[model samples]
Target: MFSLADLPDTIPIFPLPGALLLPRARLPLHIFEPRYLAMLDDCLKTQHRLIGMVQPQEGSAMSAGRLHGIGCAGRVTQFSETEDGRYMITLTGISRFRFSRDVTGFSPYVKAEVSWPDFQRDLGGEEEDPDFDREVFLKLLSRYFEVAGLETDWSNLEEADDELLINSLSMLCPFAVEEKQALLEAPQLVDRRQTLTALMDFTCRGGSSAPDELLQ
Candidate 1:
């Protein structure tokens, strides 16, 4: 329930690779690392309880590396602490942000100054993709799944709404880190769908030989 005016200029960030959190989508995280566990503790102490989910650039060490320019900020909606000193939480995406600059601090986790103007539309309700061709996309998805040796409940996919279906696939698909960043930075639902379709098509056409091979 955060308005644009309510978001802070600085927030703690979690730089994870191959993880995507779209607006209104939920992401579950396991917080075990000492630093991240400290991050969870700090987040719970704040009113917004927002955490920025970003990706480290490809070919860079995950512990210390440059991050992608765009990322989503999620609010900690569900949280629980296990007996073994670990934290489990679910983040519901709030808005997408553009990275400004890293905020140097004594904290163990990374913090960044971010701006949210470009993705103001993300603050709205679920988006629509009227031009999405569900039948064709499903056919491609089925073929892609077969080639990748993955399985899913077609009935569930068929019943999902456009936003749910597309966002979930964009998040869950085993795309490369850069590809996931592309999906995260895509301007709109239609754009993401096209990007996703192209990626699946690429994978279906024996494009998996190189892990670094990206969609053109």
Candidate 2:
């Protein structure tokens, strides 16, 4: 368990448009772009190894896009360099933070001042949501996979805890940027489970709509 007091005052940020991460979840990122390669190099050198996983606001460009207030900070738990000079890394979530402000001349990638007060609970790990219905989730997931021509290891899905299942489903789903953000912003486990359930249903039925519709 990571302590909030150990959290940094500043960290490097990755402004991927549709990528989302949740606390205790693992996000695997391939560092190929020059800018991100530079960023990874810096992280390896300094050993800070913490990157903020955030989405660019909807309808915005990466260079000039506004970020949603919330994002998760992850630690580089796995790393390997390839012959092509590319780095493959896995970041395991440490905690969620809200965007406070940005500063210049920090690093090649974007940097931001972030606060974790709103999501301190995430540090405690995933809480069980009694109101959450796992059967419903599996039913919808089965239907969506069938429709999408996807397959799963039923045993693993059955053994996964609430947090793992929700984050895995949320991360793997081909939902839009806003939908991903909604999963990131859910106040707690039950809310995320509920939101994810709706999204799964919509996908199973081949329905598409805005994030707000699914949340509602």
In the order shown, what is each candidate's alpha-carbon RMSD?
2.0, 1.8
Per-residue CA lDDT of candidate 2, range 15-53, in tens?
888778888899998989888898778777765578899
- Local lDDT at 172 for model 1: 95
Model 1: weakest 10-residue lDDT segment is 207-216
Candidate 2 error regions (>4 Å): 210-216
Clashes of each: 0, 0
Question: Which structure among the candidates has the greatest TM-score?
Answer: 1
* Candidate 1 regions with alpha-carbon error over 4 angstroms: 209-216
Worst lDDT 10-window in candidate 2:
207-216
Clashing pairs in 2: none
For all candidates in order, the CA lDDT equals: 0.89, 0.83
In order of appearance, the predictions have TM-scores of: 0.95, 0.92
Task: Give residue 109's lDDT in candidate 1 (0 to 100).
Answer: 90
lDDT of 1 by residue, 15-118 (tens): 98888999999999999999999988999999999999998888776553588888999999998989999988999999999989989989999989999988
The true-structure Cα RMSD of candidate 2 reads 1.8
